[model samples]
Target: MVKEIKLLIKKRQSYIKEFWSYINWGIIVCSWAGVVIHIFRQTELKKLSNSLENVKGLKPISLTFFAYLDSLLTYLTELKKLSNSLENVKGLKPISLTFFAYLDSLLTYLLSFCCFFGTIKILRLLRINRRLSLLTLTLKKSAKQLLGFFLMFVVIFVAFNSLFYLLYHSYVRHYSSWLDTALTCFQMSSRHLSTIPDLKKIDTFIAAMSLFLFILLVVFMLTNMFVSIIVENFNIVRREPFNHENEVELIHFTIDKIRQWLSMSTRKRKIQTKTDPITEFPEKIDELMLAVDKLYGNTKR
Candidate 1:
């Protein structure tokens, strides 16, 4: 049954590979189309600007080859943002439209950045099946730990930033701007630890400490998950019976092979004898006894 399941998994994986090959080509074509559209739009804008009387002598600067690369990146980013916006529309059940819009904006920005790295990962997966397989297995084992760490890290970071903002608003009455207040608070926090102290500073310190602890906890949990997964898979792969009920079958096969080789060796030893067969039998018996003794010794050690 396990072997059948394994074969089924292999077949499914082959189907997935074929599906991804077509999907990857489609994405590549669409991405190129987006790039071409961007280039055409830019060209038309430049032409319009050049048609003006005051811009007759002002030639538009030619975009460097790298600019085309940048445009491709920008296109992918926009595609990811559009996908996230659609997700936001789907998630507008329990939340207000305004709140959903803000959530959508934040999620879209975060997902856009995530999509860039995801694109790179997908490319790698297409190029190397073994690495992708290993990564997939690792992700499956650590998914819960990874999600826990991500949520904890985000919560701690946001809480610290929010507390800092609140403290700035409460203490400082007149500042040039929010940025100035932020900079001033950061400078003050760095300058005096013992000279000037207050509850707000203590609150900020506690928040920072909580953030540090959360980060440490995340690291420890992830490391534990990674190590446990590797060890478990290694044991599963290297086990003698391959975690099946055919252990005695394998042992019997191995013993038969060993007996055949020993029989052939004994025949050769008999044919090449310079001494009495009776004497040689005792020596061979002694050798066998010594080998068994050594095996036992090693096992004990």
Candidate 2:
């Protein structure tokens, strides 16, 4: 079994290595192809531009060619600028800097997403442990309820976000946009509470009322509902019965089996004590007699 497992793992690793090898080769080929194509295009365009500049008379054909060449150069320049903006960040134009910033932000978000899912995948391996399985089990059992709750939460959240944006967008800086308003609301819910003071400074009456409603609807109601759902599902998951062995038990069982298979167990094998054949035969006969008596004459007709 161990040999077979090792072979299977090696086979899988070979396939992964081959896949990545092909991907690397393909990237290299495509990159060189792109570089060659770009070089040829640039040289050809430069030749055309030089020839057009030396023309003595402005013929209609030359004029049209010059115009086309100018437009192409402009496009190529923009493309080169874009590539340079991503490749080299020093002394970038404003538009290029903005593009670079957006690219960085996007990469940052993607990395965060990758890390988040990677952690979840790692945690999945710990499901053999009882303590770790509870969290996953709870989520599995309460997935539907959580989804429904999240949808409802989003609806309520969006409504409040829009309200705050409309209410305080003119006066308060925090509620400037939908994103800012949502963030501000999250901060308030998380016990930051500075948004209320800022809102109150703008309009005392509106801020007081908005605070009461937000707290009642969002902070108190939604927070408690989410906690209650999780707790209820967690308790249910805990109460459910499972016969599967946990991580520690499984590990010990595996270790014992391996030790026994290798003839290395701490407890030695027991040896049977020999008895005389005459005494054993008499005992066997007595057992046979009891069996016959019980089968034939145990109950009287």
Candidate 3:
């Protein structure tokens, strides 16, 4: 009975640790979500203000602390003229529906991606699961390659999307704007090509080429590389015990760097506090400083 109780207590502690890790990941994901929310809020604020006949009457909106106060002050100062300006306020640009949807869907996709990874992290709580351990270790080793591949894909996606947007926005009458071009490219890569309509022959050829590129790069090359990486690293993971001292060292190094950065200005400020610049230097520079100061003093005299 005592042995069973001890085992239960250990398992409970392990579960709590895993829960804490999952919560930490959730907090990190929430930070990213906050950024996305702020961006969308800015966009929506602009859309709202533009829709108003008198934007000067609208309240100030910003992500900064004193933004609302600044906007309020500006609006109050222009309150007398705000009524008069409403008569001729006809220059508001129509906001694109696709762009609005794109922003929202992008956020959803990102949140889902973070949650998927967080779920995987939580799954590591099963201490008896060797497969999970191996998978995690393999991913840890291949992290750099995955990041590099992601950056490469981003550059390619942006470049081709820009090319397609430029081509379609000019020649194809169906595409409403450049935003549609980006949305279409994203959709095509995901194998959801129903929304994009038919275009000019040249535009069609570019779209087809983009589809082929997505297949060749994202679907085949990167996927195959990742598979190979996992298989190669799995052997190493199986042979080596789970060692986290490197991660602890890395965390410590990161914290030290952050501390140094935060104190850098304070250190500089301290150096500046010296009335005589010569006093700020180490003893090694004292001789050079004395020679320069004496020469300058003599020259001035």
- Give me the candidate number with maximum TM-score: 2
- Candidate 1 lDDT, 86-157, residue by residue in tens: 353332233222332333344344445545544745644442333334544555455666677667656654
lDDT of 2 by residue, 25-115 (tens): 4444544554554455455545544544544443322222322233445645655654553344333233323333333334344445545
For 18-99, candidate 3 gives per-residue lDDT tens digits of: 4344455564666578577658856764664556635554444332332122344553444434344444545545433345
Instruction: Count clashing pairs, candidate 3.
Output: 0
Model 2 lowest lDDT segment of ten = 60-69
Candidate 2 accuracy as lDDT: 0.66
TM-score of every prediction relative to native: 0.33, 0.52, 0.38
Off by over 4 Å in 2: 1-105, 246-301
lDDT of 3: 0.59
Ranking by lDDT: 2, 3, 1
Per-candidate local distance difference test: 0.48, 0.66, 0.59
Pairs in steric clash, model 1: none
